[model samples]
Target: MTTALHLAKSDDLPKLSALVAAFHAESGIEISDEARTNGLAPLLNGIPHGAAYLLGPARAPVGYVIVSFGWSVEFGGMDGFVDELYLRPAVRGRGIATEVLLALPKALAEAGMKAIHLEVAADNATAQSLYERTGFRTRDGYRLMTRVL
Candidate 1:
């Protein structure tokens, strides 16, 4: 059996950091310790006000998901962004990630969120398929652009 772990407190930082670092490494995204530390501060503080959850056995975290809040006039109210999701390679094929994706919207709705969004790399067909299977569809009308300043 699998369990869902809700990380709603500052105490969850270490586990979250480890999981994110593992994900970055596995995905070939080079990140520094300081970057990871700085990046996790908001999630740890629960600032920008969001939640992180883990899926696996109760004591060990095999995967994690981070959700953040935002306003979307198009959705007619507050929406959620799935900021990050990562499951260990060994555990990838077991449908756990699919379960987490399915469950997150319900959890967010309970918190009064109206919608959820995520961005997967254009070439990442595996992830796109999973998202589509879970009710997320691509928006063809707009292009996602970003600038680092």
Candidate 2:
């Protein structure tokens, strides 16, 4: 499937929110509506901290991707974390996500991002395999650890 990505704008909030809510519910993530709004609003409003992209079509996107930026001396410069990526159930396994994964990194790299990262559930072998094919690899002796503030 050939799809395009649109950088989400503030006006796209309602559509983005609906898609995010669907993704969260499907993935068993339990976040409140307010939290979701708080997180997505900044990205949509052109905050340098991150960006949200609507996949497929602006009017009715098939999926969405959220990428957050951070300075990483270890990586020699800016790095991006793919905070969220989701495709509607009807679109999964059609290479749409793979295309995004492949294309997004190159775009980021061109924009001076040194590296990109994403976390997948340990048991989700299918996702891991796809990520690997798209050039992601497990780092030996390192694990992602996070604490909510």
Candidate 3:
């Protein structure tokens, strides 16, 4: 089945929050509602730092994706990292995520994004394969390291 991505707006917080909570729970990411809302609100409000999209029907979205932006000297311009991507359990294996990944970068590139990045668990071969098919490759010896601010 085909899917559509609606650029999320401030009014979309409630629905987007629900989807985000579901994704965090399913993925074992522990976070409070306030934190989630705090993180999501700015993006939905049009912060240049990132953007969010609702997948499927806007009023009753089945999933969501968020991409955060930053300058990358190696990439030579603005680059984006896929902060989160999730679809409801019922919609798994339908190529919906693949379609979103493919289409999202095209739009971002048009908006001057030089590269897009996402992290898949080392053991998640399924997601790795999906990412590979959609044109994401490992950075040879480079690994993503993070520190909580």
Candidate 4:
């Protein structure tokens, strides 16, 4: 039932980092708090490269989402990638994510974001189907390639 995405602030870092830690652990990502803090602090401090949002009450968020901005000549303007999304296990399948996915991108688009993109595990059909419901189409013949610097 939680559908609001409160933009994060520097003062919220401790709580937000805990949520990110939980999400990373659940996803099998081995990350240190120092690393997490380093990454999140800039965004929270208004660095413009990305953003994080608490999904639900600001004091007791049920989940969080991170979005990183980009520019695409192909898309003709600014775009964004859903860098990460996480919901507490107790809250899955209740259509909270569905509501967020459906509403967030539209809100972003209205704010002049040309497009929003997300990556799903090739095997996570449920997530894929969920994203597809929100009008995210798989780019035919294209796979996301990345190099970690």
Candidate 5:
């Protein structure tokens, strides 16, 4: 089925949250309900400096993408992070994701964003391929390291 993407509204939070939780579970990442409740709620509601979108038919939201904005000197201006991008497993293999990635940058650019970025699991070849096809290249000199707060 072909799905269209739209700016996510507050009413779509429950479905978006479920999809996020499922993605977390499938990836072995533990996401607390409190985080979803307290954190995501505000972000999706426009209380934060970011945006989220839902992708699916008009009747339902089957996937979502969350983006956060930031300054990037390297990119010469504002940049964005694709904090999340997910399509239900049943909807994979179709070109929906590719189309989304292809279209998103134009929208972001029009909003004054200079670049967009996303992190994928090193072993996720499928995701890597999709990203590469969309013009994302691995930075040769950088390693992503993080410490939990």
Candidate 6:
């Protein structure tokens, strides 16, 4: 599977949304379709805080990745978080996701992003290994805490 990242556009909403819904369902996230669409639209519209990418063919993407930018004083100026990443089950076990993880950050770095981060569930050893191989290390003692507003 190719790991080329195609920046998603406004017109790609329908397909992207469906993939997101499927991914969320598979991951057991219970967000409503309306909520997901509402959240994704602005990013597709080129919002500065975040961006979405369609992996492989744009028309029938094999996977998707969404990144949200922020200012992290600790990491320096601009930083980004891998808000989501999803590849079709049939396409897993390949190095496609690794390719994206390795390649995308260089592009982002050139664009002035200082750091990149992601969150993986504690029990998901496969994902943890993959992330570790790609240079994402657990920050010693830090944990990701969040508040839904």
lDDT of 1 by residue, 6-103 (tens): 66457777777888999998889898988887777777676875777777764678988888889999888889889889998888988888888888
Candidate 3 per-residue C-alpha lDDT over 1-149 given as tens digits, one digit per residue, 9 for 90 to 100 = 36999999999999999999999999899999999999999998889999999999988999999999999999899999999999999998999999998999999999999999999999999999999999999998999999988
Clashing pairs in 4: none
Global lDDT scores for all candidate models: 0.82, 0.94, 0.95, 0.90, 0.84, 0.92
Q: Give the TM-score of candidate 1.
A: 0.90
Q: Which ten residues in a row have the lowest lDDT in candidate 1?
A: 1-10
List the RMSD of every prediction in angstroms.
1.8, 1.1, 1.1, 1.2, 1.8, 1.2
Per-residue lDDT of 36-129 in model 6, one digit per residue for the tens? 9999999999889999999988678988999999998987899999999999999998899999999988899999999999999999999999
Q: lDDT, candidate 2, residue 91? A: 88
Q: In lDDT terms, which candidate is top?
A: 3
Assess candidate 4 and give its lDDT. 0.90
> What's the TM-score of every candidate structure?
0.90, 0.97, 0.97, 0.96, 0.92, 0.97
Better of 1 and 2 by TM-score: 2
Error of 5 at 41 (Å): 0.9
Tens-place lDDT digits, model 5, residues 1-149: 24577887778778888888887888787869878767678776786578888888745777888898899999899999999898889989888899889888888999899999889888999999999998888999987777979
Off by over 4 Å in 6: none
For 8-108, candidate 4 gives per-residue lDDT tens digits of: 99998988898899989988999888999999999999998999988988899889889999999999899999999999999899888898888888888
